[model samples]
Target: MGIVWRAARLVERRPQTATASSLVFVVPGWPGHLPGQHVDVRLTADDGYQTVRSYSLAAPGDGDRIELGVQVVPDGEVSPYLAHDLPPGSDVEVRGPLGSWFVRRPDQTEPVLLVAGGSGVVPLAAMIRARSRTGTHSPFYLLYSARSPDEVWYRDHLANPDPQVDVRIVYTQQAPPGSTRRPGRVTRGDLDKQAAQLQPDSPVYVCGPTGFVESVSNLLIDMGWNPAAIRTERFG
Candidate 1:
């Protein structure tokens, strides 16, 4: 069946990082979605003006509940509302569980490499959660890049011990005290090191802003990773 717009109630909200928050909604009859899917959220003002924005699902759910991690964009419309103004128990319009290419299937046994920049980690987080929920032993590595330790979404949750998932945080602007690496963008060396942990045929999914996605995807191609094996989704 085609996806439809439905009214969803904001049931819970939690702060993920300094600039991001995780919003959970209760949607009745939310046809189950796969990891890496996104939904379009629509908001309306009292004057009947409306705006819509798409957000990736942060975790896989059993068709009744969905989570989205929204980063407050400076001077943004929807994001600011989602991050701060919206209150629990408020109603929002949602449409989707969309996109098909970037999704991860549970039966696949190959290693998975997920790379994210800034808020782009949202969909990748769904894939990671799905892997854990299904009890898949496939080695999964997440290379997440943010401005600093404080800006990394789900930092505490990513800290939770999971032998199957290996997370590496790359700080671009600032690094915590005593950190060995200098603050910088993710380098070819970083990708090389993580790629070594997975097989040559392993699928790589990269998500982030346009420039970040372009740079990473090009680097993966230059690294001899098969172009077809690298799936990318760009936002902003």
Candidate 2:
């Protein structure tokens, strides 16, 4: 059976990164969800042709509402429908906290490397939030990439730091006029340099588009990190 939830109300909807919207939903009596699990969003047309899309939940298990940072795909039917048609008070039907394959508790002493590309930063963001909220002492290193400054999701949240988090922003497409942006995607060199900054035996979490995930995963492999030491989640 599908897990069902009612949209209690829209708390906030704002542009996170370029072409991405971060939405907070308050479902009354909502069951909390894990960091990386996603919910299937069900939408039906007036003619009854139904469509379901799965999106990862970016909120932690706080016993509160759920949050989703949706990066609307260009020419995508379901995302566009939700972005444009769904209003604040409109109740959305969702089935989740699905997918057992996700990141969970790790050693508080093991340094964490969180890498996010575009909207793939959603899950990593959730982990960061959870760690801070629970007062875990894990050292977090975030290397987030976006097309440009305007597209970097959670820029404000990252810049305004809690004592428990450390974050960096990388841009591949357009850097500020006078600034130097490392050309292309996150490279082996980038991963190596960042990994060197941390203590040995650190755990890594990688999220982003499939290409980003694959490339970073391979780079981590080449850097002498065990496949088990790195965790990843991907989106189109």
Candidate 3:
């Protein structure tokens, strides 16, 4: 609901992977946000040139602090700065808590199926965090895909055992030593395993690049998931 441009100062930065990082911004007077909303980050240069890019929130509401996960685009304008150069006290302008289609509220008690690819895991991670922060007991199934073991964001937290959530990590480019799954994109069998854990009316959220989202969404539909019950947000 917040559409005004607010001052956001970087409070912390944590490396998520070799090329991605999580940026914590303290936006004073930020109206709390839901699980999957995104914000527009605007940067103004000394010459009065400005550029804006949208980034998904990496966590749920926590007072005035908002977290964003950024993946560097080698030739892009904004991502590189957000991921690497912006110092801890530097300020930027943010306009958000935008998009409602992919969000999940804290009180929704149905089983949840989350499918994330590459850096798209940011917002879904917010949903996971929200479920924990609010102490809800809804069942969670997360099927995450990355290019390699090293590119997995929030690695330790996702790997940590949680009684209410089931997590399966699949690699597309390189599989680590002793890994049971081969290096490839998520196959039908992956969704098959998760599909069994959810009920007929349970909601599914999918986020990734356009192709990955399209592929997974179609597979879920073929495997009997209701298209209307599946929410998707795609990038690139």
Candidate 4:
């Protein structure tokens, strides 16, 4: 069956960072979504021009309420509206909860590794939330890279200090004052240390800009992780 576009009302908005915000919608009859799935959003202008974009679900939720974390793009057609202009109670068209290749199912019990860059952490965050929500103790580790500490999304949520989910932050451009780690991209050494924590069969999910995803995925392959066990999703 074709997925129908439904009007979702914006029920709440929470700021995650200076440029990113989490938008929650009340969608009646929303089909449940697995962690790492995304939704296609469409916005129409007054003159009838419309634009569509895809954003990952940021958290696991009941089928009725959907959440998306939007990062404002300087010249983007849709994201600007979503991040800055749209008011509460506004209605927008959404279709999806889509894509299968990148999902993390509830039944997955093996160790899991997630790597993210910039705003690409969206879906990976969903996977973490799903793991916690399902009460799975299978080890999960996240190595997230961003330009600086302020640009990191969901900082507090990631700071939960849960022993079951380990999150390591890497700053590519700048680090906060007094930070111990030098500012740089994710290196082979970083991956090696984290990879040692996982079983050989652990499922690895990498999401980020095309270049970042490619670099990390290649590193994992070089580290002898199975290509079949690695899943990736790339964004701008």
Global lDDT of each model? 0.89, 0.76, 0.92, 0.89
Q: Candidate 2's residue-wise lDDT over 77-104, tens digit each?
A: 8776565556877666677678776665
Across 1-236, the per-residue lDDT of candidate 1 in tens digits comes to 68899999999999987778999999988988988999999998999999999989999876699998899988997898899779999999999989989898767768889999999999999998888888888789999999998898987779983787889988999998999989998889888888988765679999999899999988888888888899999978
lDDT of 4 by residue, 1-236 (tens): 67889889999998888889899998897888999999999988899998899999999877789999899988877787898779999999999889999999888888889999999999999988888888898888999999998899988889884688989998999998998889998888888878999866689999999999999988898888889989999987
Tens-place lDDT per residue, model 3, 1-236, is: 43899999999999998889999999999998999999999999999999999999999999999999999998988898899999999999999899989999866988899999999899999999888887888789999999998999998899894789889899999989999888998888988887898875589999999999999999988888888999999999
Q: Candidate 4: which pairs clash? A: none
Quick one: best TM-score, which candidate? 3
Q: Which numbered prediction scores highest in lDDT against the true structure? A: 3
Residue 144 lDDT in candidate 3: 95
Ranking of models by lDDT: 3, 4, 1, 2
lDDT of 3: 0.92
Ranking by TM-score: 3, 1, 4, 2
What is the TM-score (0 to 1) of candidate 4?
A: 0.96
Which runs of model 4 end up more than 4 angstroms from their true locations? Answer: none
Runs in model 3 lying further than 4 Å from the true structure: none
Model 3, residue 126: what's the lDDT?
A: 97
